[model samples]
Target: MLDSNKDIVLDELNKVFDTIDNSQVDQMVEMICGAKKVFFVGVGRVLLMLQAWEKRLNHLGIDAYYVGEINEPAITFDDILIVGSGSGESIFPLSIIKLAKKYGAQTIHIGSNSESSMKPYEDLFVRIPCQTKLYLKDEIHSDQIMSSLFEQSLLLLGDMVAMKIVQKKDIKDLHLLWKKHANLE
Candidate 1:
């Protein structure tokens, strides 16, 4: 790609960000804050991103768990499950969503399509505005390939929600997060 085209690509990304559902973002933050225990599930890079969010939530002193990790525990009525799947059709995550629902957990699904099967499973749906492999040739599109746009937006979305939580709780010290950091080197 030429240097001159970089601005155009960025502008396109900005367009997607500009129209993101602010209400959904607010609801996500509230769900995280209100959940007694928060568990996350996704695949590939999306999973990696959720792991990053798990660490941040721990930094904020929230009980955050990554699904499929050895330390993950059973979900219950007081808990919440957060899932990110750009395609919204991955069997592993959908299965986990079902199990979480059976356990009476509040589920939040973040993906591109509001019509995704995951929709019915979640209590709240966060529809990210970007292209996924499942709908690349459709009207909506992304300059970046595959699910990059959705993944990127998901990362930022998580970060923004974490920041809001930190602010709401008045968590001001960097040392506090450091204390929660793993001690075994």
Candidate 2:
């Protein structure tokens, strides 16, 4: 039964990958690789995905931080902020994006809505048309619990982009990435 459930979930995720536009992925990679610094934010479980992205970006030698962390630097004109909000209306990420933009940081938004309110603040919007809990009524067809597909696909998306960044920088030595890991651990 668990295997059956897993298959159903994977099938749903296939739809999400199919729906993502390649152009948006390219835009996201270009923005990250070009930024002076990169910051990330999201709310709830989605936030976990973004936080993981922060670590991976750092591993790849990019200056990246999870916003609101104690040591995170302030946004600047040369920085970029990448946020994932399934609803595109999550108030927290939206508010942070506004501040980051006010300081001249380029903002990239990842959500399931192209017409989302957060769109106006974003320099790049990567819409992955998956159903989220915020729109459960509109997504009665989804079998999994709220927004699982989006979160799963988000992790995959982030890792794929990070891999590209590694290749672009010609980072062939895995030990180099490992050298950047926090020693406190």
Instruction: Give the number of the best model, judged by TM-score.
Output: 2
Q: Which ten residues in a row have the lowest lDDT in candidate 1?
A: 136-145
Task: Please provide TM-scores, in order, for all candidate models, with all chains considered together.
Answer: 0.90, 0.93
Q: Going through the candidates in order, what is the number of backbone clashes in each?
A: 0, 0
User: Worst ten-residue run, lDDT, model 2?
Assistant: 133-142
Clashes of 2: 0
- Top-scoring candidate (lDDT): 2
Q: Which pairs clash inside model 2?
A: none
What is the alpha-carbon lDDT for the whole of candidate 2?
0.86
Tens digit of lDDT per residue, candidate 2, span 1-185?
99999999988888778778898898889899999999999988898988889989988888998888999988899999998987888889989989988999999999887677788899999977788756744332358887888888889899989987887778788787888899997
